[model samples]
Target: MHSVVIIGAGGVGSVVAHKCCQLPELFDDIVLASRTESKCKRIAEQLDKPVRTAQVDADSASQLVSLLQREQPELVINAALPYHDLNIMDACLKAGVHYLDTANYEPRETACFEYHWQWDYHQRFVDAGLTALLGSGFDPGATNVFTAYIAKHYFDEIQQLDIIDVNGGNHGYPFATNFNPEINIREVSAKCRHWENGEFVTTPPLSMRAHYTCPEDVGTYPIYRMYHEELESLSKHFPSLQRAQFWMSFSDAYLQHLEVLSNVGMTGIEPIDYQGQSIVPIQFLAQLLPDPAALGPHTQGKTCIGCLVRGVKDGKKRLIHIYNICDHQACFREVQSQAISYATGVPAMIGAKLVLEGQWRQPGVWNVEQHDPDPFMADMNRYGLPWKVTELDPEFQLDTEEHQATNAVH
Candidate 1:
């Protein structure tokens, strides 16, 4: 039996608590904590088993260390914002606890997403005999595992990688983000970058677009190339790759709204004087947006996320697509949350479970793909997010005319 502390009582945090409680034997004691104690208590009320609830600002390492000292949990699952990742990791080290999170750290002042900050702590975690798993969420989490699984089973050498994320779900709101509005907007509005021959090529945000026809008739949508943190780790971990990129589907309405917001300076992260009080425009806008947790009941449709890999196997070039399709209503029925939160939260629980089971526990800061993907892939099928792997024709190509034209070889 293991005791665990879960921070951030938001949508993903709530699902993590519920999933952890499902296996009482493994997680005997669970404590859900966040800045808003009431949110934690509310989520606790819905669980089949009672979990301890507390309030602590995750930004304060001392407060977290004190809480961990009192609770003495073996692991801390951080479902909080990306900005608080370092503080929570520091607290875990001080409290002598293993750490896991669904996202990498991003400083509050910048929208840049990279794993260098967390990766720098590899020696610290190793010296302390503690484990810190970063990017345990869907794209960075499951998708990373999917790539590793494919490489282990199907590829002799991976030559190209494309991670496509599509959320066909609708929340019935004209303008609302599925997760934290601030994070979502920042990620979408940032400059685009993709790994190329021994370097990264930078482009304007949403400048490179490709039409992706999802399997199972999930609808064809325009996927815009963007720089995601996983691309950095994946390229470094798997050096065979000559090119790598990440793409996400976006609706016209959403893009239009984002453009208007950007034009009006509503999405700016820099603080400006407002009535003698310095305020970040994006933070203020986040306050006015609908809470993502409250959108579950009103959300419908599905999300398809996967990795498409082109590699060589047995001296023959091959392509494989491995993905999972999640329904919002089905997830809500099980966890009272949409598939977005469910997809991320389920993996968070699985990562913690692996650490507790000693399967993935090791003394170092690591990404999900750094471990064996077989166990994680098996758990995904056993859990809610069932995935499928399909081999594509060798002649199949993902590059669109626009993509080819924009990225023309000189």
Candidate 2:
């Protein structure tokens, strides 16, 4: 029987637990831990399988290590905030357990997220004979695998790559983040960076926009290029990628509200003195926003997330699109989460299952792309997230002057 401890009791954490329980043959035991034990218990009640709940501050490495030691699970699935990634990884090492996380580690003081901090721990994890899997969530997780699977089967060498994520879901909130508000605001508000000419080019946040029409009537959305952690690792792992960009759909109303928040300094990450007490504006603002986990019941519509690759195949130019579409209501019915959390959490569970099954269990810190994507891709189909691949005309492209002109008119 394989035992795993899942940290964090948010929407993604809940999804991971529910999916893991669905496969008792693979996961015989699960312990969901969080800062507040009640939150963990709440998630436990939603599960069909019995799950043990524990309390531990993810900010404290010592506390996490203590919990890991007590539980002594084979692996720790970190569905906690990105800020807690490193602490939980450290605990995994101390407790001599494998580690898997959905996102890369970022210092809470900064809005940026990078793989260097966790990648630096590669040798340590290797020396300990433990595998540290990074970016197992949707964008970084399944998207990375999709890129590799396509590259392996469809491309001789992929030169240009674009990852488009569109969430057409509506939760009826004028202003609410699909994930953690602090992380979402910080990421979306950060300066954009894209890889080109073997170097990363910097641009203003959401400065570059394109109109993307998703297949199967998922609806058309305005996608803006932004810096996501996957770009850093994907570029490193796939050297043939000359240009790589990450694009996400955002509503005008959402952007307008974010702009107003930014203008008022409400999105700032730095702490400011308020009534002689220090408080971070974004943190306070997050508290005011609707909880992403609780938005599952109200959210409707779907999300289309995938990679568009232009490369070489058999001495001819080729363009291939691989993607997955997830409906918010369907996910809510199964895991009690919207597509945003469902997209990320499903991949997290798949990655952890692969690790436990020894299909991706290799010692050292590694990104999802570094492994053989075949098994992971197969699991994605067998699991809740089924995908589709379509070969488009070689001339199909995302960013062009035509797209710009169309956006300016609207």
Question: Which predicted model would earn the best lDDT?
Answer: 1
User: Whole-model Cα lDDT per candidate?
Assistant: 0.92, 0.91
TM-score of each: 0.97, 0.97
lDDT of 1 by residue, 185-214 (tens): 888888788999989998877788889999
Taking every candidate in turn, the Cα RMSD to the unseen true structure, in Å, is 2.9, 2.8
Name the TM-score of candidate 1. 0.97
List runs of model 2 lying over 4 Å from the truth: 399-410
- Total clashing residue pairs per candidate? 0, 0
Predicted candidate 1, C-alpha RMSD = 2.9
Error of 1 at 75 (Å): 0.1
Clashing pairs in 1: none
What TM-score does structure 2 among the candidates reach? 0.97
**Would you give me the overall lDDT of model 2?**
0.91
